[model samples]
Target: MKKVFLLILVISTLAVASQLEIFSSSGEWAFFENPARLLSMNKQGVMGSYQVFSGEGESLGTFLVGLFQTPAPNIAGVLYLKRSTLTESSYRTTIEYDAAFSPEESLNVGAGVSFTMDQEERKEIDLHGGVSGYLFKDVGFGVSVRDFTLWSQKGTYMGGTYLLKLFYDSSRKNRFSYSLVFDQEVLENRIDFTIGSEQKAGLGVSVLSNTKTKENTVKISLGFYATVNNVSVGFGTFIISSPVSSDPFSEYYYTQGTGIKFAVRW
Candidate 1:
């Protein structure tokens, strides 16, 4: 059988609480980090954003709604609601929060947490705690370990997911901008990797794939985002080849979708 464990498969139903952010306050963060960020907006004020996404991959359909605030001159507050229900698994929901503080002219630090339903059988990896920071020259980085506590229930063997992201681009007007990202497993023998770029007027793409051979596969990502009079919207898609696992007729597939996001200052 193919270990097509497309982990982030629960895109349809999850119960989660979240916060809406005003990240597009500045045209500098236009793409919402999705490459589709060509959107425009305010620079030094508060802003709120909400995004709804849905698509299909190796598993059933996945859909999600995101609300958050972008980093500004002061501390940033955020919330996220994520629900995953696919295969034979029950509906799983996750609630998360992010608070950031700026102590220097060009540096920042923050922490976060996610609460979710517990599975006894998947003990030792349910609760997650994470931290993030920013560097100099418009470059920033974030890392979080989900399910750090590893709380398990029933026979699900529930574990947490880890995420890491990096972004860097200039704020020059009418100029080309670019960005990149990386994601991997927290404590298992699995890893997912991707790297891509974007532009100012709204144009970009990226490649996503796995490191291990049996699971070796590749997908290209395309995205764009823009704003008009405090309203921002974004769209993205990923295309990949069929399954490479044994029994190629195992109903293999990939993913592609369009997303819309809106934000305004408080």
Candidate 2:
């Protein structure tokens, strides 16, 4: 019984620690991070992705389904559902809806709301908002807030997490971007740097630091994307650095895992 309890505790800790590191604001998943980016989509499309993270003895799987549409000349909206499961008895599901409005050609503002439910039927609601626009001819910036709880079965909180991102696009088809994320609730911060072409392939590196423990984790990703006749598909993989565990039972902490992603839009 003691060993079973310890195993559950370890898995829960790993899931929480890895949650922030798995998703990216670049590529097809941009709307997942900043809803304001949906304004850039000109056509209505549906997309989905499945990802798995695995370690020595356990694995976690995530599935996502989303769609975006332009309702008016300058208004766009997206709706998505995400599910994460560690075991049949342990899972979480979230549904999110976001909309962006462009008042001018170069500027957009957006807001989103999400509802989440866990295996135990605990429910939570979160609000998000963002702004994105061009600063220079080919330079742009985005700012967003995530996870401001409107209500929760556990409790209610204010102060959502924050993200700031900047990007530069060259006429030659290359784009470079940097993002910084601050999450006060967990006392952790993350930085992501990516270089890629909107036409083909890209590479990215991310560093996540725990302010309280002063420990840092590094992750690397590579992906390729293609577009044909208004349809787009993308594939990517990532690997994370492992953390050394001091636990007497476990040799290596499960914080490190490899994952792959696939997404398509039409």
TM-score of each: 0.53, 0.77
Q: lDDT (CA) for every model shown?
A: 0.36, 0.65
Instruction: Report lDDT (Cα) of residue 171, candidate 1.
Output: 37
**Tens digits of per-residue lDDT for model 2, 1-266:** 65455334433433433322323554445666787877767777665666566566566677676777887888888888888777444887999999989888889888999999988899989999999888988898999998788898966464567888887777526667787776652232333333444546666776656555666777666665656555455556666586433221121234444433333343
Candidate 1 lDDT over 1-266, as tens digits, reads 11122111112112221111122213433322221122122232322222222234324333344444545545555555555444445445666554555565444455555566522223222443334334655555544444444444454443334545554544323222222222231111212221222221233333333434435444444445555543444444444443332211111233332333333332
Give the runs in model 1 whose Cα sits over 4 Å from its true position.
1-73, 87-90, 118-150, 154-168, 172-209, 212-214, 243-253
Highest lDDT against the true fold, candidate:
2
Poorest lDDT segment (10 consecutive residues) of candidate 2: 244-253
